[model samples]
Target chain A: MGTENLVRKLPNDIGGDEAGKIERVEHELLPWEKRCHALADVLDFHKIINTEEKRRGVESLGAEMIGKLSYYERWIVAFANILFQKGILTPGELAVKMSEVEGRFSDVPDTRQS
Target chain B: MSEQHDHDHDHDHDHDHAPITVDEKPGYFDLMETAVRELLIERKLFGADEIRRQIEVLDSRTPALGAKVVARAWTDADFKSRLLENGRTGCEELGITFYDDTQLIVLENTPAVHNLIVCTLCSCYPRPVLGLPPDWYKLKPYRARAVYEPRAVLEEFGTSIPDDVEIRVSDSTAIIRYLVLPMRPVGTEHLNEAQLADLVTRDAMIGVIQVGYDREAA
Candidate 1:
């Protein structure tokens, strides 16, 4: 429990008592979380790509996007990317849908405006 | 003298301001998911009803399935052998079908050894039996510490083992997921399989804690 004389012994160790510190933060799942799980389930049934392949696709997004996303959020992104790659959905259609969703959200008052 | 002390305390307070909080609004990923889901639905890639059904399948899974497997292993020796040999097929004997192609491996904790699981790369879990991985399981600290300093991480979960006991940490991957079958607690000889399962907690199956015999006393 006490952090004294902490040493980073392993090169790959990202966080540990001797390396990065540990902190706990608890929060309820956001709407995107539930939706992402559903999306992953649907993608699983389609069998268009294996879990590892999907995971690699997510990893290919680079660290910045990965850092910004939640665990399941990455899955949804990977699922969508795979769909696009497979020609099931064109990039043009996805762009249109994204703008449509954004338009819907724009009507609501921005809570973070303050 | 009091004014000097007050000035010193005020200086400390200046350095103790609360950290800036990040905006918690949904990001580009959320919008992308919504977009993809809507497009998929529109194109009939999969119906809304199908997604709902799949979610229900995920929601139906719980740690009770894992507890039943553990309790059976505790009572039946042959069943335990089968479970140790082939995790997925053995669980199927008890009517537990693992989701998709993910392999399940059950680690047995003995008197001399303890097993803990963590997925350092991603939160790979035996979701068919244990349901969703807890938030802590997916966090970076637990993932990193579980591999480097398992005993310390176990202690954080309120599990303390003697220095003599060996702690083995398993890193779960996308292909293979691990579940720890905790050692059966002492003084539970009279308990039936159903009764013993009641003592098996989700945390115990995750190897963060041990199953207790307090239910018997109650």
Candidate 2:
């Protein structure tokens, strides 16, 4: 499909397209991936973000992000953007928090116990 | 980090001892996950224990739960009818609780018809029952081709259905999930329910492969 038409259609809406062989590979969920999934459940449970909103949030990340990122990666990114869009959390705050998290984990190896 | 993406069973072991050390820098998305989760926790939306418990709940579920349901359906005529009529309540009878609002639809594969499940839009799997979907299920190729070329896809999985039998592809949506109740394999009449459940595999429940009497042969 042309870029124009691909852009017009939702990135996730790739049904009936000619595709290649199936890669029958399985990956165990990483700790972060599990945390992301848990966050999704918590968000939906507390009414902070519903399931439909999260689906639309991932869809709105555009074709590039959709194609580039893995499944849980897209979800975490979408959660950040959706939280920012809802004014529940700011991008600047997330940036600062991410750096803080990065720094805290950098010096400490056993911080994973937290 | 990219090197860690190899197709292997070793990756599954790392999570238990994958410490967040200075030597091992986390990936961009990995850091984002922790950040988003911590930020939400700080906001008091939910507690860390809740996330832990939720993860525990998710981890507890596996294909064994689905297999038990399938085994019950195979042995009990009334349960099979109930399962076909309403999957959620039928599963609840087996004490398999659904964590999400999505309704489960159990499709029976008969001698005349075979069923295949796919989420063409997204990986809308019956997660509460089957745990999480496999990586390939969420990929572009399987999602794109399964709806139109199901037989070829099944062939790739080494499941060849007869041309005389009909292939029914069920596309899972956000509100609905599908689980295929595969027909019982022959020469297993002597086997009990637990033994029969052992023969039922996850791929069989997903409609990719049929339940074979000889597990090693499959």
Candidate 3:
């Protein structure tokens, strides 16, 4: 494809592109990943954001971030941005809460709350 | 060379970096997940327990659910037709609840034709029945190759389809997900539905591999 087409093409549109061998690796979902998924469900269930909105949210992240981040990583990041766009949560609020949460995990590397 | 080696290992030389490093700090995304979730709860958009319940619902789903439907179709001809006609209704008959509104299309494999599913745009999958897709399914290569050269992709999973067999690749979208109903292996006529269900692996349902019957010695 030409540069013009590539520029217009969405990042997730990778069908029929030449690619390497498939790595058949099965990863157990970490606790945070499951929680991220659940957050998606909760967000959709309550109409804060629907599934299509979330899909578009991830797509809006562009190709570079999509390729670099893990699946749920893209989602969590997208969710934050989408929330920001919707004015549901501000960046300042999220940053403050993240620091507050981070401080709670003293001496423990796992920062997720039980 | 020694100077270069020292520069590379300078940060790590202070600590014993073994084969497994357990004390690694969390990444930015990890913090974002906690922050986003906590903010959602504190804002009363949803309660924390609601998220917990949703996780429980997701955990309750697995490939066993898909296998049960496949085994039933193998034994009951009526169910097979129904599943082919409308997958969501067919699965609902088996008491499986679909949380989403996306349609489920069950593709059947025969001697002359094979079916494979891929989500090129994103990781759209039949999560209600088969749970989350395998890691390979969500990756770029499988999504890119499966639509064009499905036979080659299947071969990577150790499933070789003869040239005579037409490979029908289904590209899933956000609105439609697919499940493959693989052919039952021969010499398993004696096996019960439960026994047959046990043989239907996730890979088989994904159409990457055939359900192999390795009969334990009686």
Candidate 1 per-residue lDDT over residues B106-206, each given as its tens digit: 89999999998887766788888888888887777887778888887777777899999999888887779888999998888989999889889888988
Query: Compared with the true structure, what per-residue lDDT tens digits does model 2 show for residues A1-114?
Result: 477876667877889988999999899998778878888988888888888789889999998889888899899999998999999999999999788656644533332322
lDDT for each of the candidates? 0.74, 0.85, 0.84
B1-218: candidate 3 lDDT, tens digit per residue: 11111112223222111112224335567768888887777677888778778888899999999999999999999999999999999999999999877899999999998988899888899999999888999998899999888888888889888899998998898779999999999989999999999999998988999998967752
Between candidates 1 and 2, the lDDT winner:
2
Point out where model 1 deviates above 4 Å: A1-28, A102-114, B1-28, B215-217
Higher-scoring candidate on DockQ, 1 or 2: 2
Off by over 4 Å in 3: A107-114, B1-25, B216-218
Put down candidate 1 lDDT per residue, A11-99, tens digits, no spaces. 22243434344454445556567667767767767776667767677777666777776777778777777887889888888888787
What is the overall TM-score of model 1 with all chains considered together?
0.79
TM-score of each: 0.79, 0.89, 0.88
DockQ of each: 0.25, 0.51, 0.45
lDDT of 1 at B180: 91
Which consecutive 10 residues in model 3 chain B have the weakest lDDT in total?
B1-10
